[model samples]
Target: MRVPILRQGPYLIASIQAAVTDEDLLHLGQEVVERVGQYRSRGVILDVTVLDVMDSFAARTLRDLARAVRLRGAETVIVGIQPEVAFSMVRLGLSLEGVGTALDLEDGLALLDQHVRRRGKGGR
Candidate 1:
């Protein structure tokens, strides 16, 4: 299934609504990167609120996606990682290094705003 991505001013918000396969993640990464360039987006907010399981592959995919977005001169913030999911990732050593994370969508947006400001980039 396709992940819905919404462009909010200088930010792109992608909310993962359910458990997704590796292929879905790959597609998501590619689509997010393309959209970042296409929209000249300054930031990306990935909301995985409904995601209950976070395996190593999923963690790695998300880390790579954030890196790719960074290369496009955009910042990526992953939000809504449930407490259980976070615990599992930590236990499994699945880290999303070099990527910012927040408690929720609102927090993610705020974090992105801070990043954009720090980089001297304009925001919405």
Candidate 2:
């Protein structure tokens, strides 16, 4: 899997390219957390638009990724979820309430910027 690292102000955007399997999701989560720490970023916006489908493993990995980001003193946001996948997640009872989500990459970036500014002001 090739992960593209994009530096946009205080946020480090990671564009994941390739399917994230269950076995590799953990490592990917760790990588994202490490990258945030390395960059000292306020947040990470994951662009998973390339993924056509999201399975239970992927959803669980996302949850774990959010936790990892928090542990590293950064926030995680998921972007570009397809309608079908979103419906499936909702039907499956997967709650993404605690994690950040946006309809598109641009929206995600904006949200991250807002979050970073808020955190900076609050010293969080």
Candidate 3:
């Protein structure tokens, strides 16, 4: 299924409402990147609360998406990773190394805001 991306202020939020295939994840990455550039968004929040399983490709795609968004002058935060999924990911040694993660949508937005504020203060 195609993920829907919404623009909110300076951020783009993509909420994955169901399980996704590799193609769907790839499409999501492409769409998010394009939307970030199109909207000149300052950050992106990917809500994956509904996903029960995340494979290596999914993890890599998300990690890459975060990196790509960062290069476009935006930050990316992944939220809503269920506890079981997180544990599995850890057990599998899958890591979203440079990506920011939060407990939920609200926390994700706060994290993005924090980054922006820190950058502003540091003149970065």
Candidate 4:
């Protein structure tokens, strides 16, 4: 149940797969946030393309995770949401508020850089 979090300068990337329990997801979120502080990361990119179905609880967990990261002074971007999943989540009123998202991992990384630049932090 160890989630792999990779550091890249001032950023972290977490690619989550399926078959995860709610507890595991919570643990993963905690680890990601902790690593942000440990690494002093300015940005986080969570690749959720591998997730096919996300329950409301899981969605909430993600939202909480993003907020937690932001509270730690880092921007978080959720990337790789499938078209259908995106539609379903929106339809279910699970749209992640106050959270950033991108089409894919590459786009998410670019978005993070943009956020940093917009905040007057030069690109790394």
What's each prediction's clash count? 0, 0, 0, 0
Estimate, for each residue in 10-101, the C-alpha lDDT of model 3 and write its tens digit.
Answer: 99999986767789889999999988989889999999999999879999999999999999999999999999999999999999999999
lDDT of 2 by residue, 3-87 (tens): 6578887788877666656666667777778878788888888887878777777888888889878888888899998888888
* Regions of candidate 2 where Cα sits further than 4 Å from its true position: none
**Ten-residue region with minimum lDDT total, candidate 1:** 115-124
Candidate 4 least-lDDT 10 residues: 115-124
Once superposed on the true structure, which residue ranges of model 4 sit more than 4 Å away at CA? 121-124
lDDT against true structure, model 4 = 0.89
- Highest lDDT among the candidates is held by which one? 3
In model 1, the Cα lDDT at residue 56 comes to 89
Error of 1 at 81 (Å): 0.4
Q: How many angstroms is residue 32 displaced in model 2 relative to the true structure, after the best TM-score fit?
A: 1.3
As for candidate 2, its clashing pairs are: none
- What is each predicted model's overall lDDT from 0 to 1? 0.93, 0.81, 0.94, 0.89
Error of 2 at 123 (Å): 2.9
lDDT of 1 by residue, 1-124 (tens): 8888999999999998686778988999999999999999999999999999988888999999999999999999999999999998999998999999999999999999988898885433
RMSD of 1: 2.4
Clashing pairs in 4: none
Model 3 ranges with Cα > 4 A deviation? none
| Local error of candidate 3 at residue 61 (angstroms) | 0.4
- Candidate 4 lands at a TM-score of 0.93
